[model samples]
Target: MDLDAEFKLDDDLCYLNHAAVAPWPLRSMQAVERFARENAMRGAAHYPRWMEVENTLRENLARLINAPSPRDIALVKSTSEALSFVAYGLHWEPGDEIVISDQEFPSNRIVWESLADQGVTVRVVSLDGDDCEDDLIDAFNNNTRLLAISSVQYGTGLRMNLDKLGAACKAAKVLFCVDAIQSLGALPLDVEKSQIDFTMADGHKWLLGPEGLGVFYVRPALRESLKLHEFGWHMIANRGDYRQTTWQVAPDATRFECGSPNTMGAHAFQASTELLLEIGIDKVEALVLNRVELLERELNKIQGIEILSSRDRQRQSGILTFRVAHQDSQALYRDLMSRNVICASRGGGARFSPHCYTPDAVIHTAVERLAECIS
Candidate 1:
């Protein structure tokens, strides 16, 4: 597929902030427009077709995450909502502990912290400084019930060794959950291989879709462990039978989707997911890594700069963060934005996250623009 033609971004803007939000592919845009037109013209007459799209989305999500079954995927409004479901749904005993990385985005941190009201201890594991893995592992104790960490740290782009962490969590009998918002689309994720009990990611960032739609994956055996926190007709097994009084919540992951679905978002994201699948995840990862390496190499050539992200491939993903020696980070960010060099303020510096489809010219332009701003 012609990714450049598919996106059709403006020539003046160098969009390097796919980590924040991405421009939709042409197919996704077309899908959304068609859905809107159908809604306007035919109303709900073809609602069943829309439902098929939603199911297709679930299947694609399952494939993307390598979940054992599509029944383990739940369509949610956002990653925060999915995290909240896991946070509040579990019955925590007093003195029970949850371990998480100190560098987590607020969404991952705050949800676990909220459990303090129930006497649950929230342990913040520092992934910075010395011995990151040991520090996190040391935090686990007899009372540790869960270890929640992002597959890729949002700001610094430090990719965790999920397989190793999963093995440790399993040995300790603690539930392992991954916040995959930053890693899902840029890298391949395997729930079974990683032994992830739960995972969630919003489609807007790496998936190249829009906001207000996310994929939630819950392991089949663990599905029964989480208490149902939300309820609606759609969550019931007898959802189609409007007159049926006796109803039972779905036994699978569908129980987490407790209300009307986001059909529009589903339609757009399904198209987006299809495009990614067509390209293959391994190729996507290689392309993303190549761009990140190029960005890092170019950034290193500039004087008075510090690379904040990991240089090691095992610890790196799509994000490449850096800071100028004497210039204020925010000022640099503003200068880049004004010059149409799209980036983000993150990791106490500027974050330039380019995807597989990001043109090499855009990367060069971003570097030159940052140099100009600093000079």
Candidate 2:
């Protein structure tokens, strides 16, 4: 497949900010166009077909994370909403501690911290030094109820050893929640293999879809244990039987999805994920890692440049963060944007995150522009 054609970004621009909002693929745009056209002409007359598409999207998501079944997936509004579902769903007692990394994105950190009024303690562990996994697991104690962390640290692109941590969570009998927004599409994630209890991700970043739609995966055994805060007709077991005044909650993850679905976003996200599966996650991961490696190599050639992300290749994700000596990171970010080298300022440096479909020439040109800014 012509991967570059999928993006077809402007020739003058070097778009490398997949860590932020990503540009949609041509296929996704076409899918959205078809969905809009159908809505304009037929309205919900073809609602059944739209439902089929939504179901397919759910299956695609289940495959993306190797979910046990499509029934385990819930269509959510955003990562924060999913995190909230988990944070408040569980019954917490005073003095219960939640373990988290110091480098978590606010979505993963704030939800736990917000429980302060209930006397839940949020233990922030630093992911520094050689044995980051040991640091986190070592912090676990009898009072530790759950551990919430990002699969990949947002700022430094640090890829955690999920297997090790999952084992620890299992042995400790603590709940495991993963904020997968940064790593979902760029790498392969198996909820089963990792023994993850809960995981959520928004499709707008590396997934190459729009905002306002995400996926929440809950383990089957714990489904009923999580008390529901949101409720609607759609969440009823007999959803079609509106005349029946009595209702029971749906016996699957759909219990979390209490209202109408974002059919348009589902169409777009489905197309994007279909493209990724066709390309295969393992292949996509190899391609993504290759791009990060290329960025590190090229940036190292620039005098006085410092790679802010972890130098360990095993810990690197699709993101490559760096800084130039004596240059203000924000100043460089604004300058790069002005020149159309799209990226973000993160962790006291500018972050360039390219998807697997990003062209090598774009990567080279992006680094070249950053070098020019420093010089």
Candidate 3:
């Protein structure tokens, strides 16, 4: 398939900031437009069709993460909401510990830290060592109740060995939670194979969808263990029965979703995920890695450019962050943005994250623009 035709990026712009928010594919844009038109004309006349799209989105997310069942997936507003569900749902004892990497995004870090009032200690392990996984595993002890980590560090784009951490968590009888925003669509993620107890990711990044929509996966057995923090008619087992007086919380992951769904966002994200599935995630991953490799190779050739992201092939991700030796990162980021080479300042440098559909010309132009800025 000609993937380039699927993306409708402008000719003068070079968008390489997929790690942040990504431009939607043509199909996704069309889907949103259709949804809007339907709402404008027919109102809720086609509501059943909208529900079907939502179900399809759940299935798509289940397939993307290799989730055990669609019942395990919950459509959430953002990764932060999903993390909040896991954080506030759990009953924390005083002195209980939650292990996390020092490199986590504020969403992952702040949630666990917020439990401090309950005397829960948040152990922040550094990922700077050669044996990073081992360091994280060593931080867990008998008092450790959970290990919360980002599948890929947002700043440095360092991909963690989830399988290794999951195995250790299993052996230690500790719960494992993964913030998968960075790698969800760009790479393969299997909850069962990795032995992850919980995982969440927003669709805006590598998934190539809109913001305000994400998926939360909770393992089947542990669903009941998490106390419900939110309650509503939608989360009840008798969801559509308005007259029913007594109700029970949903047995599945839907229990986490207490209110109305983001139907519009669901339609757009579903279309985006369908496009990814049609292209095949394995193929998408390969193409994305190729683009990142190209950026790394060309960026390394420029004098005084320092690649802050890991060069170790196993740890590399779609994000390639680097800084010029004598240049200010923020100033350089502004220069790049001014030149229409869309990117972000992160990890103490400028971060370029290209998607599979990004054209070769855009990559070359971005690199050339960077070289010019530095020169």
What TM-score, over all chains together, does every model reach?
0.98, 0.99, 0.99
Error of 3 at 100 (Å): 0.7
* Predicted structure 3: clash tally: 0
Please write out the lDDT profile of model 2 over residues 80-181, one tens digit for every residue. 999999999999999999999999998899999999999999999999868999999999999999989899988979999998999999999999999999
What overall lDDT goes with each candidate model?
0.91, 0.92, 0.94
* Candidates arranged by lDDT, highest first: 3, 2, 1
The reply for model 2, stretches above 4 Å from the true place, is none
Off by over 4 Å in 1: 129-131
Q: Which tens-of-lDDT digit does each residue in 41-141 have in candidate 1?
A: 99999999999998888899899999988888998888999999999988999999999998999999999999888999999878985567767878999
Worst 10 residues of 2 by lDDT: 1-10
Better of 1 and 3 by lDDT: 3
* Superposed Cα deviation of residue 69, candidate 3 (Å): 0.9
| Global CA lDDT computed for model 3 | 0.94
Over all chains combined, what TM-score does candidate 3 have? 0.99
